[model samples]
Target: MKAFIVAVVAAIGLAVAAMYALTSNQRFAYQAFATTGARVSEPGTNLVGEKWTGDPNTNDKSESAHGKATGEPSHPKRS
Candidate 1:
């Protein structure tokens, strides 16, 4: 009984650690695009005019263009 309990606890701990790593490792594509200035277009979504911090010159034109075309709302808009 004691060994079974320990095994269960270890399994639970491993599961929790795996969950944390998965969530932390998963990167938001939109956020990445925004940061790198990479033009990312979805079929249904219109994410144009998004302003990013990185190099303006090196940043993709489509991305920057979208940023300019739109109001360039601040990402993760501050309250």
Candidate 2:
């Protein structure tokens, strides 16, 4: 009986987690999970062209501090 109760509790916890992930910002959640710690990139395997460095809409140079070479903003600013 105790095992059954524990199983039910675990199932409920999973359901709640799923619901939260569905309702919350999935991209930021994924980013938080991915980059919350010191991430090591394998040499020659870095995809700088596919990241914010390649994003033309971002002007923030912070990506370099994180190890990326940035370019100009692809989108024009609004007045």
Candidate 3:
């Protein structure tokens, strides 16, 4: 039982030491953080707090795409 406890403690210590060594370098640590941060989450709000943004979308589908050509025209058309 005592040997088992010592082994467990040694493993935890070794793991911590490994982590510290990996993160001790400033350049490598920051590069790892930046690359990891971009891949880990969606591009959403990460701020501390938010206020009432208000209902900005009071009007919906009110704009029209009238006379919009779908395809490229062969002749040069005047705008």
Candidate 4:
């Protein structure tokens, strides 16, 4: 019983560590893209671009206007 409990606890700890690693990796990738002024998006027929600035619509006029008013660029546009 004690061994079973220890194994369960170890499994849970491993799962949490894996989740944290995955999340951190994703965050790092986003940060790298933001720093480089690049975008990442899903491949599709529309082929829409996604800037790494944490916002989704940087090129749309309405979104841009709103972002400017809020003093935050909706997405960092590649210069």
All candidates: CA RMSD (Å): 12.8, 13.1, 19.1, 8.9
TM-score of 3: 0.34
In model 4, where do residues sit more than 4 Å from their true spots?
27-71, 74-79
Query: After best superposition, candidate 2 residue 9: deviation in angstroms?
Result: 0.4
Query: After superposing candidate 2, which stretches have Cα over 4 Å from the reference?
Result: 26-79
Residue lDDT tens for model 3, 1-79: 9999999999999999999998565332222343532422111111221111333232222244222222332342399
- Highest-scoring model, TM-score: 1
Tell me each candidate's TM-score. Answer: 0.41, 0.31, 0.34, 0.38
> lDDT of each prediction vs. the true structure?
0.51, 0.47, 0.40, 0.47
* Candidate structures ordered by lDDT, highest first: 1, 4, 2, 3
The digit string of per-residue lDDT tens for model 4 on 1-79 reads: 9999999999999999999999665543333443334433221111342333444354343454321222233443499
The 10-residue segment with the lowest total lDDT in model 3: 41-50
Checking candidate 2 for backbone clashes, the offending pairs are 56-73, 56-74
**Model 1, runs deviating above 4 Å:** 33-71, 74-79
Better model by lDDT, 2 or 3?
Answer: 2
Looking at model 1, residue 9 earns an lDDT score of 100
Please state the error at residue 68 of candidate 2 in Å.
Answer: 35
Q: Distance from true position, residue 8, model 4, in Å?
A: 0.5
Clashing pairs in 4: none
